[model samples]
Target: MTSPENAPASRGPVVWYAALAVVMLLGVVAVVAARSSSNTVSNKVATAQTSKVKTGSSSKALPQLMDGKADAAIGQIIPAVSGKTLDGDAITIGPDGTSKVVVFVAHWCPHCQAEVPKIVGHLKDSPMPVGVKLLTVSTNVVKERGNYPPKAWLDRVGWTAPVMADSTDNAAATAYGLTSFPYFVVADAEGKVVTRVTGEISMDTFDQLVKAAETGKAPS
Candidate 1:
């Protein structure tokens, strides 16, 4: 055997290279671990962002309204419908101790076109009484339909009521049991449905309905 100091120079270099190889292997493992941790953090942040998003009008759908049918939805609490407006503002129709006359209209309906201007003029002449609010839902929107953009139509008519922009699926209209354009649902201060009528209604009839809702009484 060679003396200790006479060990092969090649042997020394081999030992040094072995040690460097082990260190390089350890460094690679550390980098992999760091990358995995970062990816996990990024995935968690994405999940949290997705969970906070709110889409459409309501979390749960309400019972469908069957107007003029036996066992109608009258005397039932209206569902709390939430949606955004034409101006991207949030709005909700709920039991807030305020009487509400909610009307559902489609931009493509001729009756709605005729009815909206009349209602607008009526409201301008005699505003809703205190604690009674008038609200409109723009629903069944189709870009190819007449009056493509409802905001422009309502603005042209000088409508001042709070207008809720219904979802692509007509969530607001469906919640209110809308079967036809110019549908109307009157709710009392306690959020109970006073009356619901379909088709265009005259201002005199509309006034009566509002009175009934404000007093929590059905029209006789």
Candidate 2:
């Protein structure tokens, strides 16, 4: 039998113990809920960013070429080479004494993946000059996208054109006065420059230029 005063004091401890247990359980639940909410928010943010890059807005793509005035000086010199092919030998730009090199490359460019194939097809079977040679060069801009292909990967891609390499700084790209990739230029036999084409072109353009070279006509 306990005294009346002592009884209340003993009951107080039991009450306090139950209250503490309830508080601890509530704390644990709150922590778990907060972590779950944070993870959900993070996942949503990641998905949105990826979507943004894929669905580029109207402002980000290459501007469509029209009858606007284009600076012809953009493509003045041939894009020089800084790397060899997959084999240890030096990658040759042209065999013909007067070579007409068509460089298919990009500036940290994903579009190059598509444009490169078309350029390759044209150079393989297009009507080039009898004494002219053609080539494709990849600017080392792929490192920016974190998807730079191995040198060998660029070589095997259905290209009959001899491929060359550029420095990460794109030194060869600068010589042609091009600030972008998939650039084109025609060099005369004596290494005199003909014309510099700055945008993506079709096989017809290559043929047109070859005809232009033969006729001494500047490419339109």
Candidate 3:
């Protein structure tokens, strides 16, 4: 039997409770939004870090070669050479217990530019001897030279031979007696230098050199 004006006084506690619930709900919503924002930021940072790692791995700096004439000689035991490939894999020469026909080339030499493809084509048509391995050394790399980056040039020509990048000091080339561009060194299974040829050579001459290396005799 309360009067109409007194009804509001009875509902005061209920109105206060409803307002408190709304405030609590808004607080929960705000917290959820903040957490979502934090997660989005974290994901973006992780993605950027992953991209940086991939970029760092793909681009590697080329080395500089030392200035000097190679001292490699026939009948001499050549030292072992180790280096990385364009793909960043390690390669070691003369340690696999196999005869090798090593070709040394420079990116800027016109003769080498012509001779490399020739050698690659000839070898593809007529493979090396059973126990003989054909190896290529990319040496004397220079930024201002033709075929600036040797790896890209070799890829364009489809050079399938196992290639080793010489050190900044051109250690591999120096060890194998690099007297000139497009140098060929034939070595026996025990890593002994059997013979060497400088400048461009015919496929027939290359075959003779391989034969001489396998038989431990000079080509007549």
Candidate 4:
């Protein structure tokens, strides 16, 4: 038969190889697109987390201080009612039963940066005085400066003290008449204001304040 004499020959090897190459190219393009989308999503998540740390507020209580409330002392007694840490952890609500609470910090303030490492080291390693507690408050709102103390900064500085975001309204800053950075405010076990020091207080000075509060002896 005529058909038996010659059927159209199949595609040549080169043609088939070319088709296979095209298919492989398409697969590579699809994979690249998928990876790009995944990278975008990951980038968005990281940016949001870091941004929140820069501008988030813990709560709204310090605003009352602006209204000129002297009973503010009553409010500071409860730490949870005050502020929160960068990692969304509880800051010092008040002094523990055995220790007074001392806050040493500033938000944009430069000196606070220097004081952090030593203070955290002492607070972590040394035993608390009988009437000592440890707490910290931001003197400035993180604001647009992105200057707020983010968890990243705290971790980088190795500050372990329970820190509060006083940035919402400068409540802590106003409470102690903070005129500068690196301020220290010590509250006795009873949550009474005992000592207020401006500028950097040496580790020795910190000890004196705590020991004096506990033993009622002034710095030697």
lDDT: which candidate is best? 1
lDDT score of residue 54 within candidate 3: 13
Q: List model 2 lDDT by residue over 1-220, tens digit each.
A: 8878767545778889999999999999999999999887542211110100111122122222223556444323333333454333355443135656556474346566666667666656664557767666666545336434534335545655555555555444544456555676666664445655656677777676666545445676
Q: Which ranges of candidate 2 are over 4 A from the true structure?
A: 1-83, 92-96, 123-129, 144-147, 150-153, 214-216
Residue 188, model 1: lDDT of: 97
Q: What TM-score does prediction 1 earn?
A: 0.71
Model 1: weakest 10-residue lDDT segment is 44-53
lDDT of 3 by residue, 71-165 (tens): 33666665666666655666776635788888888878999999988877887888887988888888887757666577777888889887787
**Two-way TM-score contest, 1 vs 3, winner:** 1
- Lowest lDDT 10-mer window, candidate 4? 44-53
Worst 10 residues of 3 by lDDT: 46-55
The candidate, 3 or 4, that scores higher on TM-score is 3
lDDT scores of the candidates, listed in order:
0.78, 0.53, 0.72, 0.56
Local lDDT at 159 for model 4: 72
lDDT of 1 at 178: 80
TM-score versus the correct structure, for each prediction: 0.71, 0.55, 0.65, 0.56
Better of 1 and 4 by lDDT: 1
Candidate 1 lDDT? 0.78
Model 3 misplaced stretches (Cα beyond 4 Å): 1-72
Cα displacement (Å) at residue 132, model 3: 0.5
